[model samples]
Target chain A: MAEMAASGESPEILFWVGCAGSFDDRYKAVTQAFVKILNKVGVSFAVLGPEEACTGDPARRAGNEFLFQMQAVANIQVMNGYNVKKVVTACPHCFNTIKNEYPALGGEYEVIHHSQFLQQLINEGKVALKGGGEFKGKKITFHDSCYLGRANDVYEAPREVIKALDVELVEMKRCRTKGLCCGAGGAQMFKEPEEGKKDINIERTEEALSTGASAIAVGCPFCLTMMSDGVKNKEREHDVKVYDLAEMIAKDMGI
Target chain B: MSILPQLIFLLVFAVAGYILYKRVSYLRRNIFLGHKEDRNDMKEQRWKTMVLVALGQKKMFKRLGPAFLHLLIYVAFIVINLEVLEFIIDGLSGQHRIFAPFLGGVYAVAMNIFEFLAIAVLVSCFAFLIRRNIMKVDRLAMKELKGWPALDANLILIIEIVLMFAILTMNATDQILAERGVDKYLAVEGLFFSGLIQPLFQGMSEGALIFLERFAWWFHIVGILAFAIYVTYSKHLHIFLAFPNTWYSNLQPKGEMKNMSEVTNEVNMMLGIQTETSNDPPAEIGRFGAKDVNDLSWVNIMNAYSCTECGRCTAECPANITGKKLSPRKIMMDVRDRAEEVGKSIDSGGPGLEDGKSLLGDYTTKEEINACTSCNACVEACPVNIDPLSIILQMRRYVAMEESGSPAQWNAMFQNMETSFSPWKFAPTDRFNWADQLKNEEAK
Candidate 1:
C-alpha cells in the first residue's frame, strides 16, 4: 500500500495474501503457485505487504466483535488510503468477510476468491492449461469449504478450475449445499475440539476417502490444512495427496 | 336456575381468570428483564410471516406424517375454542343450549362440526401420546426432555383426550334427556360422534342422567380453564407466542451479521469521520456482550418462551449430529429455565438475585456453546424461528470480552492479530514474499 502511495498510482488488482498464505509453511506454496500464474499471465497486481490485516473474521466469529471492528477499521483505512478497488484472495474466510461483511463497515470492493479469479482468467484466455497437462486421467475429489460453498454459494468456480486440469473429478456424497465443515470454521481452528464422538474433519475426510480418489483438491487454505491432517490421521498421506486448486493448476501448467 | 349456581360459576371463572392474568403478567415482566431492541420495522413482511409461518404452519410440513397429525390437533384446538364463548354465556345465564333457539338448524350444524373436531382432537392426542411414549421419536427423547418435559408432553395429551371425552359425554347425555321430553333439553339433532356415544346412557334414569350431564359439563369447562393456565407454563406456550414470535422474526439476509453500532461509532471517530459530543456525560461502556438474560435483547428472551422443546433445531444441528454437546433445543430450554429461576428469585427477594449462579455456568456449559459452528442450520430448522445462534453468540461474547476466557490457542491468535495484523506471528512485511518469489522465478 505504501509503494502504491509512493508511486502515486494503484495496480489493477490487490492480491490479499491472507494469514495462511502469508505465513503457514504449506499454504505458502499455494500462494506462490497462484502468484506465479498471475505473473505469467501479466495481470497487474500489487500486495498490501505490511499493510494487510487478518480481515477480523476469526475475531468476529469468536464473539469478540469489538476486536473484529478494530481490526476491520484499520485495514479499511489502509486500503482506502491506497485507493484500492478490486481484491483477490486465496482464503474463503477473507473472501466471504471482505465481500459480504466489509461493505457495512464502509469498505466495498469487487472481491473474488482465487478460484473464481483463476476461472475468470482462464475463460478470458489469459491463462491456458497446456492441454490439461500432468493431472490428466487422475481421480481427484474436491472438498467444498463451508464459507465458499454454503455461506457464499460459490460451488462451481473451484470445480470449474479443477475441470480445467482435465482430471476425473469425483465428488463426495455430501458435497455442494449439504457439504460438511472441515471442523475449522466459526473460529474453531483456534480452539481444541470439545468432547464429541469423532472429529468433524475426520468424518469429512472419510467421506472424501470413500470416493477412492487418489488426490483431494481444495480451494480454501483452512480446508487444505484440515484435509491434510485428516489424511495423515488415516496414515494415507503416502496414498493420497492434497493440493489447493492453485497448486494443482501451477503443477499442471509446469510453472 | 338458581342464583347459587350462578354465583359458583362466577367464582370459579374469576379464580381461573386471575391465575391466568398473574401468569401472563409474570411472563411479560420476565421478558422485559432483558434489554430493549426495536424489531418493529418491516410491518408488511412481519404480517406476512405471522400468517404464513404461525397461522399457515409453513415450516411444520417438512415431515408429512407428523405435520398432518399436528395440523389435526392444531385445527381442533383453534376451532373448539370458538365454543368457549358460548360456554361463558351459558355458565353466566344458568341456561342450557342458549344459542340453540336463535340459530335453530344452524346450531345443530355447528354442533355437528364441533363434535367431529372433538373426535379428531381425541384421536390426534392419542396418536401424539403413542409417539411420545411408545414410539419415542429421537427428537422427543433428547436428554433435556427427561422428567418434567417428558411428563408435560404426556400430561397435555391426556388432558386433551379427557377434555374431548367430557364434551362428547355431555352432549350424548343431553341428547338422551331431550329424547325423554325433559324441559330445556331442546331435542338438538345431528350430534354425529356424540350421538354414537348416546347409547352408553341407555339404562340410566332421569335424575342419574341429569347428574352425569351436569358433571360432564362442569368437567369440560373447568378443564379448558385449567389447560389455559397450564399452557403459560408449558412449552405449549408456543400456542400463543408463535404468532408474535414469527411476526418479529429476523428479516435480514441470513449471511449478514448484525453490526455493533457502538463499535462502529468508535471506529468512525478513530477514522476522523465523526467527532464525539463534548457535552455528553461519560458513557457507560458496560460489558461487551451478554452475561445474563438481562443483557440479552428482549426478543431473545421471548424466543426462550416461544420454544416448543420439540428438538427440531437440535435434530438438524450439524454439531449435535456429529456428537457435539451443543443442542440448540437445550440452549433455548436453558435460557427459559434461567429466566424462570431469575424471575422467581427476584419475585421473592428484590430486583436482582443474590445467587451467584448465572445463565452461563449454572445452566449452559462453555463446551456446549464452543461446539457450535454458527452454521445457521438450527435457525433454519426452527418451526417458530427461534435463533439459538444469537444467544450463543451473546454468551460467547461475554466469555471472550468480559471473562477473557477463550482457549489458549485463541488467545495466541488474538495476540497475533493485535500486533501482526494477521493470525500468524510473521511480520506483515513478509506478506508479499510469495509474490516476490514469482517475480524472482521470472527473472531466472
Candidate 2:
C-alpha cells in the first residue's frame, strides 16, 4: 500500500466510504481497521478521499445518465492516470460500475467487490479473526446484495468468512447466489421507491426475519441502510439488529 | 419409368439439392451462427414459433406485404405444381396428354390465373432484386447483404423468373398445337415462335410439332428441377424451413418463464443456441454481458431460415419506433448469421456445441433488451411469424436467473420479485396490506 502510494504506479482502490459507511463511523473505522490488517499481511490497498463524489448510480437509476456519467468519468480518469490495475470496493454498485461499466466507456481495470477481496484475503490466510464477541450465540442471516450476489457472483466468500467467525449463519429461504435485492441499486437511494405493493428492502428484511435470526447480516453499505430501515419501519428494531459485515467482524476481533 | 429421363431429373436435382442444401445450410450455419445467447425458454418456443409463425405467416400482414405477395406466388407455384406432378405421374403411367383436355376445359382459367400470378411474381422479384442491389433499398425486416450480394442471390432470382417463364412458354406452345385446340391467349403464336421452332427441325412435317411440344415439356420439367435447386441456396430457402418452423414453433412457453434447472450432464445438455460463443454477438449482449454465441439454441436458426425478411417484425417493434437502438429484423438477421456460422462449424468438424453464451451481453446489450418493455410488438408483426420477443425475454431470463447480466433497474425488479410474488418486490407489510377480507361472505 505504501509503495504504490509513493511511486503512484499501482492503482488505488478508491474505496468510496459511501453515505452509510460514512454515517456509521464504527463500520468505517472497522473497514479502515481491516485495511490495516490487510496492510500488515502485505496486501496492497488505498482509499479515495472521504468526500469523493458518489458514483451516481442512484442518479443514473433515476433516469439521469448525465449525472451518472459525470461522476463515473471523473472517478475513472482519476483512477486511470494512477495505473489502476484493479479496484476493490465494499459497495457492489461501485465495484460493478468500475469493473464492468467504466471499461465499456474505455476505462479498463480489474474491479472486485470488497467481499470478494476479503474472501480472497481470508482464503489466502492473509487475514484471520477471533470468534468471541458481544453478540455471541446470536443467529444471524446474511442478506446478499444484488450488486454482490447476483451481479458479481460473490456468493460464498462472505458466508465462508462469517462462518469462520462463529456467527450462527442462518440461511433465509432465499439466500446466496439467488439472494434478493435491497432496493438500493440503480440510484434508488436518491429517489423515492416506485409506488408499488411493498418496499423491496423491507420485503427482503422480512425474509431475513423469517429465518429466525437475531440480526440481519449484510455485505453492501446501502443494504445495511435499507434493511435497518426495514427493521425500524416494521417495529422489529428491538428484536433484530442490522449490522454491516465489518461491524460484526470488528466486534468478533474485540475492537 | 423412363430410367433415362428420371435419371436425368434425379441427377440434376441431386447435384442441385446438395448445392441448395449447402447454400441454405451454409446460411443457416454461417450467417446465423455468428453470435450466441442464452435462450433456455426457446426449447418450447421452438415448436410454438414454427407452427404459428413460419407456416402460418402470422406476421405477414403485420410486415412483409410485398414479400408476402411474392410468397403467395410461391404458394401458388406449389399448388399449381401439384398439377405438374399429376402430369408427370401421368407420363409415368405412359400417357403425356391424358388430362390435357379436362385441364383445358375446367381449370384453364385457374391455370391462366396462376400463370399471371407467376409472371407478376417474377416481375416483383426482379424489381426487388433491383431495389436491393442497384437501389440499395433494404427492409429493416431482412438482412442487408454485402453491396450487391454474391451472384448467388441474383442468380436464384433469375432462375425463379426463368423457370416460371419457361412454364409460360412451354404451356403456351403446347396449347397451340395440342389436340385440345390452341389457347385463346396464344394470339399470334404462329407469328412469334412458329418460325423460331421450325428451323431447329429439318424437313419437319405437321406431326413434328408434337415432337416440339414434347421437347417443351421436358424443358419445363428441367426448369422446375433447376428451380428446386435454386430455392435451396437462396432466401427462398424459407420455402422449406418455414413449414417446419411453423409446424413445430410452440414447443415452449413465451410469456411464462420456466425455472432454471440444474442439469448434471452439462456435457450432453442443450441450451438455447447451437452455435458460436460470440466472439461477437449483437451490440445489446455485448454491452452489459455476453459469454458466447453458441448458447442461443436450435430455434433461433429455425427463425432465421423461416424468416422471409418481410419488414413486419421491425415495423411492429415498439423499440424501433421509440428511438431505441433496436430492430427486431436486425436481431433475426444476426441470429440467422450466428446460427449459420455455428452450423457450418459443426459440419466442418467443429463441436456442434450448445453451451455457455450469455443471453445478455456487452455484445447484444442490456440496453437493447431493456428497451423492449415486453410489448410483444415484434412478435405481433412478424411475417413468416418470428417470435423474437420470446427469445429476447429468455435472454432476460438468462441474465436475471443465470448470469446476473441485468441492467441497474432490473436489479431492483428482481429484488422485488424475490420479496413479493409480484415484480414490484413489495414490502411484506404492504404486500397483503391492500387486501380486505370478504366482509359479507354471502351474508353469513
| Proportion of native contacts kept per candidate | 0.52, 0.00
* Tens-place lDDT digits, model 1, residues B223-335: 99999999998989999999999998988644456777667777667657654556776456666787788878889999999998988788867688779999999999988
Off by over 4 Å in 2: A1-255, B1-7, B13-59, B62-72, B86-98, B101-104, B107-114, B123-157, B175-219, B251-254, B263-294, B351-367, B398-403, B412-444
Error of 1 at A64 (Å): 3.0
Best by DockQ: 1
Error of 1 at B350 (Å): 4.2
Q: Backbone clash tally for model 2?
A: 90
What lDDT is reached at residue B443 by model 2? Answer: 42
**Model 1, span A1-255: residue lDDT tens:** 577669787799999988888888899999899888888899888888867878998888888887788888888888888888999999988888888888888889999999999999989988878765878989999998878876677889999998888889999976875677788888888778888888888988999999999999999888899999999999999989999999988887788
Which 10 consecutive residues of model 1 chain B have the lowest summed lDDT? B274-283
- Provide all candidates' interface root-mean-square deviations: 1.8, 17.6
